[model samples]
Target: MDGKRALYYAAIGIAVLIGVSIVVSVVSALLSLAWAIVSGIVSLAVLAGVVYVLYKTGAWLLGGDDADYSASDSVGGSRSASASTDAAAESRQDRLRRQYVEGQISEAEFERRIASELETEEPDDVDRKVADIEQELERER
Candidate 1:
């Protein structure tokens, strides 16, 4: 009878130990998951901070005006404001040519408009235009 009682206690002890081990494993897993979540959030916060700092620094270095720089200017060198004006003039000329070719304007009207366009050019641009005309004439010859 005493031996049976000892066996019963031993079985209970083993069961208790197994239960404790399972509980410990579950708790450890939960803690690990919590730690991973916290770590991920912290990492994202740090990344965002880094990006913001970089953005502020870049803005400061670029005179704090975002509009002053363009993506094309970054890829190539910076262009003067006059260069944009010249581009606008070129676009206008292209539109005029298209209009003339499409019969929206007569030949005499086209010539008059083109002469007016050339007359409105900046003084500095005139030399360039003359050079371009000379080059075209040479190419024709």
Candidate 2:
């Protein structure tokens, strides 16, 4: 199931558990000690069960290779992926291009930077161009 459906089910389950607990507490208060103890135990068990169900269901809904999500791994993996996507470089290039257009850099300097970027061995010349542009823009500012 999707996240929204999971949330809806969780809300309903929580409401029902709370309602039962309230009813149990009220009934216990009206009963003898022995009965009150039994009622309290039952209420606790039910609440625990509800919590376990929610935990399991949530885990199932959020699909991943492993049940355990490592904080560092998730953060690092996405960060690396994004770094390779060229977004970072493109943003930089746009700024540099703007600077060049605004006469912050002489045409020869701009061409030189572009040429150097094109000659980079990184295999992602587009990204390098963007990075170069961004560098120029940042320097201009």
How good is model 2 by TM-score? 0.26
What are the lDDT scores of the predictions, listed in order? 0.66, 0.60
- What does each candidate score in C-alpha RMSD? 9.9, 22.9
In terms of lDDT, which candidate is strongest?
A: 1
Give candidate 1's TM-score.
0.45
Query: In candidate 1, what are the lDDT values of residues 37-133, reduced to their tens digit?
Result: 9999999999999998899778856645343443323223344456456665655655665576677987667667766777878866655554544
**Candidate 2 lDDT, tens digit per residue, 1-141?**
699999999999999999999999988877878787898999999999999888876765563333343232221222244334555343444445656778898766876766664454355655644555455546666
**TM-scores of all predicted structures:** 0.45, 0.26
CA deviation > 4 Å runs, candidate 1: 64-141
Q: Model 1 lDDT vs. the true structure? A: 0.66
Task: Kindly give the stretch of ten consecutive residues in candidate 2 with the minimal lDDT sum.
Answer: 70-79
Residue clash pairs of candidate 2: 92-134, 93-130, 96-133
Best by TM-score: 1
